[model samples]
Target: MAGSLVDVALPLPVYSTFTYSVEGPVPPAGTRVLVPFRREERIGWIVGAGSGAGLTRVRPILDILEGEPSVPPELLELSGWIADYYLAPLGMVLRTSLPSALSDSSRDYLTLVGKADDVGTPRERKLLAALGQGGAPRRVRTLRKALAMGSIWPEIRALATQGRICHQTVPPRDPPVRTHRVVRVMNWLSDLNDRENMFRRASRQREAYEALESSGGSAELAHLLHQGGFSRSVIRGLEDKGVVVLEDVEVLRDPFREEIRAEPKKLVPTRDQAAVLAALGEMLQEPNPPPALLHGVTGSGKTLVYIELLKEVVHNRNQGAIVLVPEIALTPQTVSRFRAHFGDDVAVLHSALSEGERFDAWRQLREGKKRIAVGARSAVFAPIPRLGAIVVDEEHDGSYKQSEGPRYQARDVAIVRAARVGALCLLGSATPSLESWQNAQIGKFRLFSLLNRVGGGALPPV
Candidate 1:
């Protein structure tokens, strides 16, 4: 019997979606799948159902990358809108919305099959040595780095043809969630007399147990060991005696974990700021709030207004928010301020972060662990469930416009996303862009002005 047909979008420059057949129940749109494209297999996203009425041949999907949809349904719709508006391929737009790690294709790994000492050339010997006998298969890229040379593909192909090495294609693995082992005292150790008797011989074990007890009976394995200057054997001794149990626990890779968090300050808003917040609060209640332009001069306390408004949105309304800064240079200060106000409720995203860091941050926002995302232009695509507000600071800056394919204006995208999700979009700028100013003038956007700086300070003479 024929399999179900679905439309798949590859990460190529092509403008069209391809049809592929699947064996089991059809994977829903937004699910990632591996499909045969010409001679090579490519990772593609299922956009929708496909019709096999006219086509004589439809390739079967090689594999389904994810059990659940990696791209949310709403994001699929948003990507479609972006593609249409920006005249970009739907696949490219979808790619832009997700972390690059998610789109990595299968890789080729080489392993030694024949005698390594009998190689024809020194380079081949080096390659074989890199893949030691019975060692794990290594990728060409890894071998290249180990050998400190460029383009080993020719040598790899020659070795393979000579039956000196074996090749295999391995699918990309998901990023491992960070985790650490934790130690906890067993309830049976609660008896002081029994605990004393158990630890009478082992002084170091006793000290470690006492430290764990002081730490509420549970602590990270590394921290517990470090605090007591104890070795793993000491903990193992306690574990063997049934005094404590060790287990692994998942931990988030927080980018701001090292920075000392600032104390949150409660500042009274100026009269103008209060009025603007009041107006935005009312707008938030609407089904589809019109985007608002906040024309506040420098030193007008625009950031404080954002913090207050986000407090209401996140704490009161039980929704999420995304704050977009124009440059990576600005992200540190913006994130610091937001983190001070929101604590771990905030997540940071940008190009400066490593691939693993970016993946973790995206996951945090998607899983609702972090309710606010503060970053640069790319952050406008943050997967914040139940989004209630989007704040674009310095909305007029050219940094918000992406220069490559799928050249999107993040400020504009934030407005569209907010509208789609029935959230309030706030664009704040000391000098508003002409398009936004005109939009406000023609009633396309609601206008709010901050006439004076906070603390009775006057604007510098222009």
Candidate 2:
């Protein structure tokens, strides 16, 4: 059993972090831990390591949310800063910083358990009628919207106790977690001599075994069936024969998919754009790379410079890059360019993604399968282990300032994150934010300017 109490931060209005005891290995900082708070169970992020410094009567951590901690130490520290600077709860800052799917909330719903006739009271009958109309689990809030009552718990509880309709607690699953079915060959198959004697007249089993072995000894069952042209029966037969093992493994669902595949286009940078790229490249080699402000007019090939810089950093240093756009609307255009250059190595994150998709993209980044993350302001929180660079496009846009909840400015966060990981931070804009421009003037940020448009297109004289 784990000893020492760990400090966890909840999204509640509380200003101080709470310490909780754990019964297993102490969850490292940045991991999500489930704990009993007040009268309810709530999910909180582990911000500090276990300690025995404070009061003795703290509650034990209910559970660690996942096998591995999702949030990185840099992000954990960044979130703490946001919490302090914005005067918001640490949990609220985390809620906005993390992918929506990771957070959990409690919900109450009514499920039809048995006959509604046993429900004696008129209000109970009304609740049962509402539950029947849905023919599915009806959330308390959803039923309340249909009924004309302020508090319906009395009737709901009565119906539940009578075994007519039951009130169920809907565990919060943001985008809802899911798993992938995978197949792996049995250990005995590792010996070449055993392959022939293992089975007789089992061609289907052989097919699955071959597919699994070909895929580095393990493959997603559905992928094997569809892509490898094998049937479920074939895999099942292999499993029964002890030729392969089948199991469900948790995986993220990808939400951002292109109906029409996008082709990557490379722009030939003009003289000015080439100079900016050169400057950015040089900046990356410095011991402490200064944050750069790429002050360019619209259509001056600023994005091309960013792409070039990202390619240089990731391909050369084997590190990851984050590209942040001001709005979700910009994600498509930005993602297209990044996808073209990085191929499947890029991941896009935004609010529009379902919980599963966001979780999947985030998992890909954390696993080092995807080296680039491009999305709205929240993309800054992407857990890219060895961050090489961060490019914030439209740095002047007010959309970077999250108005609600944590109210953090993404641009500043980008700079701080980059510095923490020894990465480059690039702020590109047509109309630079006044604060950023002032920073450049005061030499706080290294300023690089693109005076002329790419292809020598001149702006209209004012």
Candidate 3:
């Protein structure tokens, strides 16, 4: 029987997806696969199953790169819509939906096989020398940098053919998961007198044990060593006596590390804010509710309405949410507020973060460890499972339109994505965009107006 075939989308400028045969059971859509594209192997996304009957030749997939689909089904459909609506390539759209670290392709690593003196050419000898007598395999890029010349592929290939060197394609490595050692009290002494008698000989161990006990039985190893002035030997001594245990615990990197400590403030909505939320709450109850345009003056408590609505969507309905800010500058403030309310349930995503930080945040949301995501334009694509609401703050700002590749308007994408998932889309702005204004005027969007500012503040002069 013929092997099952699947359609793959390569991250190139091509508009059509290519067909490849799956040697085993066909993987689901959104699975990343390494496949031979012409001469070079490239990473591609599995969009869906394909038919081998129409094609005369279909290359078998080299490997399924991931155990699970990197892109979820709802996101795959959302990416397709964005591609079709923006006239962008589907591959490019899919690539945009994921982190750049994930899209990296495999690279070639070279290892020395034969003695360096046996090489024929200076370049080949230099390459083998760099490989260092069968030591750890060196990346081809590293060898080229050491040679300080362009296009060493010819020399490297020749050396491999001569049996003097061997090359292997290594898949891209993901950013390491952050973790730290923590010490916890495993078994405690029976009583106060018993604890004193057990630790009578070791005062430092007794202090460390007391510290751990005061810290609710566990503390980060670093904190215990530095702040608590405890020595490693003391911890080891406790572990040896079966009084405590050491463990490596995964730690989520917080991009807004300092701002997360802000105290959460509870605010009662103003009469106007309450009314607007009431109307929006009603609309949210409907299936695939129409987008709502919140026309409120600056400082008119529009954000308060959003907070209340999200509380209902997230806490009451038990679904995830995405909050899109217009600028990265806004992310810290926005994330601080959301984190204050949602605590660790919120994850921040934006371009300003390091690759590892972004990956960690994405993983948190994808795994449902985080229920709320707050970021700039790209955060709209945050893998929020069971999305129930999306709030596009300052939706009228031109920053909502991406200026580079894909060039999608994030505000519009948020609306479409929410609609596709049967969720509510809330667009808030003091001065609305022309398209949104027109949509509201034509009743295409349910319009809610906030006339009075909280604390009776006057509206800004137009």
Question: In TM-score terms, which candidate is top?
Answer: 1
Q: What lDDT does the true structure give each of the candidates?
A: 0.88, 0.81, 0.86
Q: Write the per-residue lDDT of candidate 3 for residues 1-462, one digit (tens) a residue.
A: 368888999989888899998887888899988899864678889998886666778888898888999899999999999888988888888889888877888888887774567447787676677788548888877777877977788887787788887889877666457899999889877598989888889999999998888999999999999999888898999999999999999988886666537887879988888888899889878997999999998789887787888889889999999988878447456667777777888888777788878888899899999999888899999999999999999998889898987879999999999989999999999899999999999999999998777899886575
Clash-forming residue pairs, model 3:
none
Off by over 4 Å in 3: 54-56, 111-155, 184-218, 227-246, 257-260, 264-266, 328-331, 459-462
Pairs clashing in candidate 1?
A: none
Candidates' TM-scores?
0.85, 0.78, 0.84
Question: Model 2: per-residue lDDT, tens digit, 1-462?
Answer: 247778888888788788888875777887887788764578888888656665757788877777677778788888888888879899888877777668876677778876555437787777777777758898887788889777787777776677777777755564566888878766647665677666567776766687677778898887887888987788777777777788889865655454445776746788888888888888889877989999999778888898889889889889999998978456466667677778888888877777778878888898999999998888999989889999999998888888877788899999988897789999999899899999999999999998787777889988
Which sequence of candidate numbers ranks them by lDDT, best first?
1, 3, 2
- lDDT by residue for model 1 over 65-112, one digit each (tens)? 888888898899999998889989999988899988888777778888
Poorest lDDT segment (10 consecutive residues) of candidate 2: 252-261
Model 2 quality (TM-score): 0.78
C-alpha RMSD of candidate 3: 4.0
Q: Given candidate 2, what's the lDDT at residue 86?
A: 76
Clash statistics: count for each candidate: 0, 3, 0
Better of 1 and 3 by TM-score: 1
